[model samples]
Target: MVDQQWTGVRRRVVALGARADSGQVFGSLGHRWVLEDPLSAAELAELEAQTGARLPEDYRDFLTGVGAGGAGPAYGLFPVRRVQGRWRWEGDGAELADPSMLARPFPGHGPDPESLAALLAERPEEEDFDASEEFDDAVEAWDERWEAVMFAPERTAGAIVISHVGCAQREWLIVSGAHRGTIWSDCRADDTDLAPLVDDDGRPLTFAGWYTTWLEAAELTSRQ
Candidate 1:
């Protein structure tokens, strides 16, 4: 069950979520996700179950009052914590919590070129996406929680960082090319990727495991 404090937040969310439009971007902590509609009670329950975290307050307020997805007409431009608090317009990312935050252009915080290159070498691709599918669907996409990427749990191994959000098998996240960063699914089953940290199969990976792979690859590459 979601916390009682979140009740007001949730109710406001349920009603407000229903009215949101697609591609509605909102965020905190320099991340983002497009709002679809006000998430239903069932949807909220489902999200909680999936991420193991509760949505935050301003998030509730935004979903219920202003709006969610892409960006709120009010807060969409600045979904930062202070915007909801004393600042109201300052848009502070650090003050916000997890779960409710959305993904956005959080420069200097994600993977770097050398690390990303090392990550790629550590976790090599096992299978290419089918010709029918767009090339960008291979990268893992995370939830509102800390650094995470969703992908298939089988057929992948070594050097990859992965976590299963248990998003339905049919859902696929596209992160490259023309359809870059678009979410999709086959409707047949869960998808998989070669996104560096998660091996060829899409299983959750440990930080140590990822680091070890990078170390080994760096050692080998150094010799060359």
Candidate 2:
């Protein structure tokens, strides 16, 4: 249980306006991601052990390669490297950033009364409450993390991603964006295996979009 302090690497979030492919996104927003280093070698090692989950090759390469201690290049909405310290968080050719726009839960998705009732019915333990709170705080810390919601998304994706990442005993899903409706990861496999998404025969994939083929989210706390 070593608490290793990771390098304060920078991940910039720039804003965008239009969808590059469509060439039209006036009232839209996007971002440009950049990963900066000067990180601690020890932190990387500690992260590997703490997560107990190996990062993908592309992700790993992005961290420990030529960009290990400096700004790299940009890749898609998430630039692998950049030339600045602040993340591109504005309207570009892709989209833009708006905290007020995402202050609510989901865009069209409101609070699930049924879900809330179910939660209140079950009095979770102190640890459960603590974990949930932590998850929530982390989600609020980042906007682009909204790729974990299928509901109103852009408004709640960040929260959902936090829940998934901070979950100590449940499966999680990750989408491409707030409303992309894709799959990311299923923490609770048949046993306790934690691998990326796969096909029918077990071939790895770049991404799985969004899906609910995993465990029931609400059930995570009550199960234990």
Candidate 3:
């Protein structure tokens, strides 16, 4: 049986595409309002088997009911595909998600706050250096330390990159641990830690809630 959660989602998206001007929305041009094919039961099974983890219910249903990807928030949903019998998601920085580690629990927090603060305090400022070359070298070394703390692979375990909002900003869907099924924002590129995407009430957004909310907003924008 098709998952009822996604029953009218595809139709709604298609209808929006027909009327909505893509240019009106940011990152719409990436997908052009197109949806890729849904995954079959066998394919989904194969994917889960390979990854050693079951995807969150809402996202699993989305793969079977809606499309595997396309026409979503930001630059659209990253498409998952089987290449040479290996399932992987495709998009800018999508490879950051390690399929082998999907079963691990996601670390809800990034680096220690005190340590992060110290590192930020130590960030190199060009104006502090007399020579441009010295400043460049100092900044580059500082960036390495920043990336080490912010972009550590273990920080994102059990999550998948879902969407990109440009400038290296992306979003993740937690597939394991207590936060499973919720969406989280990735702004490490801007020297920020990952955070849960919350509703106006500050409740973490589940996969269904996140997508439906975006769909509703897109519909509203289209009608305007």
Candidate 4:
């Protein structure tokens, strides 16, 4: 049943390509979509092997059944082929430059709650510095370590950029760990941690859920 649903969405995605070929815009976001050319299954497998993680079934289906790249939320979907070489993280200093990191499991949770609370409690007080230089230095060292923990790789390990949501917002797909196949919104470009996309019921969205929503949105606009 789910396969049938995915097939329908794939058709919609294919239709977008047809429109693009005919020089027709499907929606406001249509201009942004560079409808993907189809990709071979062998190529998709190579990508999966290189990353050392199984791609989400829906996304795998999209790459082989729909298109290799292009046509998605925000700017457009990133092509797996183009992901080679170093990935420059624009928003923050953290970039998944190492492909080996993609093989690691993605962290299931965000920043640790207890650690965050502790850092908050340790806010340097003006009075603390006046007490002694030694105390101030100690406080500064503690603060630096706390900040590093806040942005540790565990926050978004085993994820790769799948799309650019414009304005430094990036959409990532988890490839490893328990969260594999989930879609996460990385607004760290806006100084925020990577967060999962949830439905009205607050359930974390899967790859299909995220991509299909964008496809449907484009279809609705095409009729307007």
Q: Estimate the overall C-alpha local distance difference test score of candidate 2.
A: 0.29
lDDT of 2 by residue, 98-194 (tens): 2233222223233455753453344334455458787566545422222222123253332122112223322222222342222234232121222
Q: 72-168 in candidate 4: lDDT tens per residue? A: 7665667655445422223222254245677788876767677666766776676766567867787788767765765566666788777766666
Cα lDDT computed for each candidate against the true fold: 0.30, 0.29, 0.90, 0.66
Looking at candidate 4, what is the lDDT of residue 92? 22
Ranking by lDDT: 3, 4, 1, 2
Candidate 3 residue-wise lDDT at 20:
38
The reply for model 2, stretches above 4 Å from the true place, is: 1-29, 38-40, 66-204, 207-224
Candidate 3 per-residue C-alpha lDDT over 42-137 given as tens digits, one digit per residue, 9 for 90 to 100: 999999999998999999999989999998998899999999979999999899889888999998988889999999999988789999999999
TM-score of candidate 3 to 2 decimals: 0.97
> Which portions of model 3 miss their true places by more than 4 Å?
none
Pick by lDDT: which candidate is best? 3
In order of appearance, the predictions have TM-scores of: 0.21, 0.24, 0.97, 0.70
Model 4 TM-score is: 0.70
Q: Candidate 2 at 46: error in angstroms?
A: 1.5
Worst-scoring 10-residue span by lDDT in model 3: 17-26
TM-score of 1: 0.21
